[model samples]
Target: MTTGAEPDHGFAWPDVLCAPVRSLPEHSRLWVALSGGLDSVLLLHLAAFCHRSRVDVHAIHVNHQLQPNANETEAFCRTQCAALGIPLVVRRVSVNIGQAGGNLGGVEEAAREARYAVFEEILGPGDLLLLAHHADDQVETVLFRLIRGSGVAGLAGMPRARPLAAGQLVRPLLELERAELEHWAREAGIEWVEDPSNADQGYDRNYLRHTIIPGLKARWPGLARRVRHSAGACADSEFLNERLAERQWTECSKGSRALSVPALQALTVVEQKNLVRWWARKRGFRPPVVSDWSQVMHDLLEAAEDREPELREEGFRLRRFQGWIHLVPEQPEVPVSPVTLLPGEPLHWAYWTLTLESVANPESPSRPIRVSTRQGGERVRFRPEGSSKSLKNWFQEQAVPPWERACLPLVFAGSGDAGELIAIGDLWCSEQYSGGAPAAGWRLVVRRECD
Candidate 1:
């Protein structure tokens, strides 16, 4: 109860327990990812006992509300932190189960996603978030990935430290065994809440932790260390893979969002797969998981030139256009109806931002300047008296992708069918609305944001 006033109780912790906590990366504020479990509780006390005076120590508890004793765990964390004179931040998150990877597995993953989301949002510059993952957890993660037919990167398990949001996430006890932490925790008389879900074997990780890992450990005494060694080897292989991908990415890319199809085709299938995954990750999107890369790569690189082949992922897609593979972000929904453009007020249509500014003085548009998607049969006149060209023919002349043609914002100077196309989504603008001096005394400025 209340950890009996203070931790340690005059019991000296060995150097093995104090070393990891004492040595940490440079950080102005230290944060413990407290779950009110044995590992996190011990981590909290270790942080307080070792480096509380050197840095500002705090704790954050994410209550997923998945367990029956969620509130009890949160209270326990608060009590422990309060007793140690450390500030605690508690966040209650709602985990949606049926989104992706449905079922109990989904719940487990969703809860983890929710917890990390909170951690990422809370951490700021000069801050470090410490997690309590240990060697036993590492063993479980490796075995789980291996059983799931993961690649080298997945088999590598979690890193000891990685960047999170604006801060860093460090697992100081990753090299220590769980049993060692439990023994020290008991010796220090530290109190923690028991999560009921940990005992339930319905979850994959819980099943592995309770049923499989114990037997493996009993059969091989150094199972944790051995698995950790294998994970390190996989990590090394993953690093080399990333290096090769980086080199190939540089060769294939032409300093644009798109890559040359011929250059990609020159690479081996494995090389192509690695490069594409690296590119997706570099752009902050998850790589598409295809069961058969040979078919996908053939479609992407060797498909008929006229037929546009595309691979769609969660946040982005790769579409081949005119001998080049373009990485396009999922388009945002534009206005259903035409949006009127006002002077000095910027109109954000999907990825493009438009502003109609007066060259000499602030003034409104002479006619209703509206922004809308293509309605077909629209024509654009390059000159005031020149021959008008169909929008379809103009898009073809410019070699715009078919998928992007429908979503590009079409800005018109007037309303109804008679509206003259003033701008084509930052691609082209009528002479009257462009240049340093405009005939209409106002300039339509359009800018496109990187997708």
Candidate 2:
């Protein structure tokens, strides 16, 4: 709660405490993430006093099970929420602070993902996930992201409001300094539990909060205020760029997953990057190291269209073929072992849900079979008179971009000692396997969500 030089000229805090949230929907529910820290504690306590007719108020505490006093902290939050008369949902989550992105920088981010997963899970339509992030928090976030080399959107820092799973996540206290919240809390005699990890300077955020921000403020007073304003400007610029990129994407997309390379080359480099960033963010891809994604865009634009050059990160892959930049999830190296599908067991593959519906193909094999990806030169015939065509050639004829060809699940059926391709995801099946008869082949519904 660094206040700089300003004295707490706080009025009866609730009147101003809820001003930032006045714009919330009239028929929405507001759930506060009460972390038992001073900032979150004060935020939950203050938000309880708001008029609940417009938006109902509730509290949630995610027990990360990380600290020595985690149980005690949960107890403290329960007492506080009970006193405040708000129904509290205590969610216990296991945090695996494993390597995020391509390496080991996801310690803090993993915790955030765990916390927000609970937040999003509980939210219904038109709900608000209110956080307790104050102005000082925003300042630290901006500085931290800056030091780590954030692009324009990262430099913009956390938004006051954004889409959270099925609802909206809003931080109403971004305009109020932490000092004001703490001052009002103390004046009103609010009790909060202190987190032990705040003292650990090993974490980048704690380092910035304890060792950097205070001195930065002392050297350049009102740095927090100026930084917040700069972030706002960046946010505005980002919004405009998104709108422009949407228009560019509408014209330039080859399909849901690829972009037209010729259309991208026609744009300025800045526009191209903006379009790519806009697309990446929409598809839930993390920000790649600057030059890596940049290089992908470069190769997409300048490389020969016939050459299938590709770039891949942990979760995603990018490729250029036939004047389109194709992006898809990176398929892990899977051994060509066929999964045994029983009648009762539900089959869940990577990013797909599978179900076997009774279709009319009398020639359908009853035995369990292999589910695999494209092995080159494999072919399938759609009709009795038609000759088998390569899977690659079929993909091109079907207007399926090259990037998606490798990951499409192919189902193989076996007879005695020989196996033949029977199904290609939910898209098609061989004429021998196609369903329409009274009681023949089972429809293999490989349910997947695509953009």
Candidate 3:
């Protein structure tokens, strides 16, 4: 049933919720992100009346702390949820305006990031996240991306349904218009707050909505419907492109971070960019900007064999080393100073957790040796009596990239930078000092960090 007057008895909230519930799982938690606005108010009310046998319904309100009416907005959400007999989850999030937390793009973008971060956290495996984005919002998004020079990926606009984190996010009301929701709101006698900032044309989306979209719609009636159609076409194209890219991505992928440069170079430039973008997506990072793709193609792969070019953005560095282009987080400079590592203890350093252990060796070096980054020129043998090799040679032999070698944790037997090397970055434990055997298990494990 449509949420419009075209229905025989006019628009109804229960009708709205029941239709969308068909797309949702029969047994899962249903969370509506309610902002106490007209769109969300309508959605929340409708969700409260949804069939409880199919899914449990809930509401979430994120307080960005940006507006002066933040407390009132949250309080309104709580009151409304209470009246509807639905539990509300209110999260108060800090919107940083200070130096470190300030907008890398714009304040709107920063607030959006903070809001989505909270949304992703509240969702668990198979949970359904229902958003109140409507047709007008979809038009605004498509226009914003178009004016900002987006490709098919960006032009695809907000999907009606997509998987985010471990849960599924569905925008059930995307087919409905804000005016229709408002009309229903008035008939239902539901109160909703109007965000004052929505009127401020200073924001890009607001500018497009108030100025550009209106002018365009005046010139071309049903512009929103046309734009929505275009977005659907773009989404279809992206789906097909992703299917092809996934195959190429699997073939060119070397490990978690590295891609086979030769394999990438063999593909057409478009496919290469698609594969790289897909790789970035797999790593939960944004793909490279369209503006940077040409330079990346020329410098990273097409350049001379000896040339090592890199591009860094979004905390990840896409660089070419040896025979591959690797996508790894931009690492801090390897610590020049030595850090003490006590046996059977873990030390956190540079996006990694380094743990060291030692056996009860009577003839071996004492416990609590110092650890530092690889400084080159260091020598170590697998066994105390085995032949020694430079740390550089050993790293090369182990296929560790030069950039990675410096960051691998190096454990020493003594204090200061001059300490004798005992354990090398969770890879090797020196023979004589080897936490030998299962009985004398001295080992170090370097864990890749997620947080």
| CA deviation > 4 Å runs, candidate 1 | 1-9, 52-55, 98-102, 341-348, 353-369, 381-389, 413-422, 429-451
Regions of model 2 farther than 4 Å from truth: 1-13, 21-23, 26-28, 53-56, 97-107, 200-202, 215-222, 254-256, 292-296, 304-306, 332-379, 385-407, 411-423, 426-448
lDDT of 2 by residue, 1-451 (tens): 2222333555355667767665565446888899999888877866776545423788899999989999999999998888878889999998785545433246667878899889879999988888999999999899988998887788898898888888988888888888888877777667878788888887788889999888998998888789988998988888899999999998898444578877888888778878877877778886455565457677667876566777665577667767677667765554465665543355766556556555643453475556777777778766657787787877888877654566677777774236677777767866554446523366555676546
- What TM-score do all the candidates reach, one by one? 0.87, 0.80, 0.83
- In candidate 1 the C-alpha lDDT for residue 107 amounts to 87
Q: Which stretch of 10 consecutive residues in model 3 shows the poorest summed lDDT?
A: 1-10
Candidate 2 global lDDT: 0.75
Predicted model with the maximum lDDT: 1
Model 3, residue pairs in steric clash: 382-431, 383-431, 384-432, 435-442
What lDDT score goes with residue 3 in model 3? 29
- How much is 314 displaced in model 3, in angstroms? 3.4
Could you give the C-alpha RMSD of every candidate to the true structure, in order shown? 3.3, 5.1, 4.8
User: Where's the lowest-lDDT run of ten residues in candidate 2?
Assistant: 1-10
- Predicted candidate 1 versus true structure: per-residue lDDT over 67-118, tens digit per residue: 8889888888888999999999999999986684667877888899999999
TM for candidate 3 is 0.83
| lDDT winner between candidates 1 and 2 | 1
Each model's number of backbone clashes? 0, 5, 4
